[model samples]
Target: MEYILGAVGLLLGAVIMYFVGAGQRKKILEGQSQQDQSYKLEAEKVVSDAKLNAEKIIAEAKLTAEKTFSEFKDKQEEFKQEKIRESREKFQRFKDEFKQEKEDELVELKAKREALKEEQAAMKEERASFKADRDEILKLQEAVKIQEQQLEQRNKKLTEEIERARQKQEELEHQHERFTSELEKIASLSQEEARVRLMEDVRGKTENEAMALKREILEAAKEDAAKDARKVVINTIQRMCSEMTIENTVSVFPLDNDNVKGQIIGREGRNIRAIEAATGAELVVDDTPETIVISSFDPIRREIARLSLKRLVTDGRIHPARVEEVVAKTKKELTQQIMEIGKKTVVELDIHNLPSDLVRYVGRMRFRSSYGQNLLKHSIETAHLCATMAAEMGMNKNQIKLAKRAGLLHDIGKVAEEDSELSHALYGMALCEKLGENPIVVNAVGAHHDEIEMNNLISCIVQACDAISGARPGARREILDGYINRIKELEEIAKKNQGVSSAFAMQAGRELRVIVEADKVSDQHADELSFKISQEIQETMQYPGQIKVMVIRETRAVAYAR
Candidate 1:
């Protein structure tokens, strides 16, 4: 019974194990089927997505190819159009060049035709001259026989005249002898003595008449000369009417507002110092409303400073480095402007062939002053005056040009960069000569101030024009103290000379009259003293125009009857 119960339990256990295995297998199969279905749906979705992606990619490729083709076509069309334009331009250029060539050829042909016509006319004239010469020779041949016949008649008349003259000569000799004898009897003197007395009387009377005539002629000539000189001077003065401008050492740089002054001054005044150091000018930024004073003895420096400040303010980048850069650039620009001014001045003056160095010097004259007169204006005035005077004197074109050039360059030495001990006139002369200027121009430059002897008419004209320009009323001015000091200095220069009793400055220091004691200075010594004083003044003093040193040595006899 124990064995049977064990078997039954084993079988029941086996059956239960079988049933559990079958249930688990069925659940595994259902899960596998669900996974397959899920995977199949996922695969179907992936395939559809891939097909859509392929279609999209293919469509994009087609669009790209079509776009590329269109681009290529557009590029090709553009290339064709460009080539066509190039060809058209080339053809037009060729046609124009050909037309120009044809025109040139036609011009050449016309010129040749004209030349041929002229040659033909010359040949015709030569032929006509030949024909006329032939006719003249024939006429001369016919007239030669007529002249021979007339010569025969003249010879016969001359023979008859010779015979008549011999008979008249004898009669005249007898009459002369009888007259001489009668004269000797009346005068009670020998023939020779009476002849001598008559000659002396005639000589005395003729001498008195000639002296009187000479004095009258001299007086008349002097009067006419004075009148003519006055007329010319008056006309010259009237013809020229130039405006006057006064220049000062300081320049006023106007600002838009006072606010700009702060930028110009900068932090700690560094900007101001930089500008001053760079431009060699003083910037006076004071309470002056909307203005900065640029103080400098050199006008160029003032101009540079003014322009540099203007740029800095306009640029709104004020700093030490920027200030230096602007200043340097301003200097360069000013230099170029100076050159342009020089070129323009020369062109306006109608002067040519001036060296670049001389042109630069001429430009510098715009910044310079002489005796308070603007040097450039003075030079221009002098040039015009010189040209006018030369024209008035009937000078040739070359001479007039030379006069103008010399007048313009007369004060170039004042603007020269070199340190010169010589006077401006001499230094200018040297400068011109060094630059291979004309000899007449050099002489005029040197002799304008009488520093050297004038060598030509042009030199004299330059000197005269320079004087006229300077001596014009209101052309120049001087400080009162300076003017007074100049007058006193003129007098002192003359008084210091030996044998000078007293000195007077006249014509606003244009003339110095020195009175010398007659006992101390003779007439010859007076001349020498005048020359000495002039030399001393020339070497020691600087004056506008020229000073006339006149030494007066007159003896006054004092015998008063009481």
Candidate 2:
């Protein structure tokens, strides 16, 4: 029974074990079946996804093919349109060319017809001309016959005249010999003596007439020269205007009160001395109320001192230190002022492109004076004169510019440093040449004063302008006494002549007019007197430019017509 129970238990246990194993195997098989079903479902999903992708790709390819087909159609249409345009253009060209060829053919036919008509007309004209020439030849034959008859008549007259001329010549020779013999007997003089007397008589009568003729010729020449000179001078003067009064080397500083003079003088005169040292000008603090005189040979120095004094007075500072500081500052300012003045003057004159250094020298001319005339003003006046003259002469623009430039720079040498050995003209010339001025301009600058030879009309214009400016009345501001004395001397020189009733020095002693006694001095003698007086003046007097001597001998017959 234990065996059977154990066996039964064992079998039951085995059967239960088998059943648990079968349950486990079934669970495993169910898990495998679940896995297989999952795999199959995944495969189906994959296959469905691939089919969808394939359809999408096919749709995209078909869309691309449709787009390509549309593009090809558009390209084909464009090409057809291009071909159609090309064919139309070719046909139009051919039609135009065919029309032009037909027109050309018609023109050629017309030209051939016109040429045939012209040839026929020319042939008819030739035939008419030949007939006219034949008639002219027959008329010429008749004229030849008449000419032969005229020659025969002229030959007869010529022979008779020749014979008469031969007889007349013989008679004249015989009469000449008889007259010579008769003259020798009556005169009782040799042929040479007779000739001398005859010549002397002719000379005596001719000399006076010759003298008058010479005077007339000289007057005519002088009139021509005077006319030209007057035109140039009048034109120049009309164009250029400058200050009547010229620059001077002395400056008068007006003080606000007398107390200011003392400040300028300083303690122990140290202030005045310091100012002098700084400005190179002489300070004259005279008793003249509200006035301090600044004096210097150099106009620039005097100007600086005047300006510095004015500045110091304006600032109400008066001391040696202040004076010096003010002077230094004033100098710099004045220097720049000078440069500006120069630049302005050039601009006003319409001159340009000068070297900077040359311009500075030109600025220095503002402070420079020549014979009491301000050099800078003189230069500007000269430039105006030159430009006017150049215009009147019809010079081109470049020549006109050169004329003005040369005239303005002509006196630039006067402002050269004190130690320069050359005269102003020569110095200015050298400066211009070194500064690369035009050769013609350089020549004019140096030759204005005759220090060098003139090479152009510009130089002559500059000289004339300078003379006109300097020689004009009231141009030279000199001592009153000296001017009066010189005028008196000039009159005395003119009065020394025997024919003079009265003498006057006109045009600021530049010209002398003499009134002679009509009875005592004849017109011929008047000429002689003028020549003598001019010669005496030249030999005895030292004067600027030339002196004009005029002798007037008027015969006045007074009659009362009341």
Full-model lDDT for every candidate: 0.80, 0.77
Model 2 scores a TM of 0.47
Clashes of 2: 0
Per-residue accuracy of model 1 over 1-562 as CA lDDT, tens digit each: 3333444455566556556755765688677765556755665565566556555555666666677778889999999999999999999999999999999999999996797688679869999998997686566545555555654565465445545554655565565566567779997889988666655665455445444544454465557556555644444433332222213667889999998899989986778978998999989899989999898877888889988988998999999999999998998988998899899999999998999999999999998888778999999999999999999999999999988999899998898786779888888889999999999999989998887888799888888888787765567786567778888988998887778889999776898999999998866567657867987898899986699988888999999899
Estimate, for each residue in 5-29, the C-alpha lDDT of model 2 and write its tens digit. 4434544554465457557756886
- Number of backbone collisions per candidate: 0, 0
Task: Work out how many backbone clashes candidate 1 has.
Answer: 0
TM-score of each: 0.43, 0.47
Error of 1 at 93 (Å): 66
Which residue ranges in model 2 land beyond 4 Å of their true spot? 1-248, 478-528, 531-562
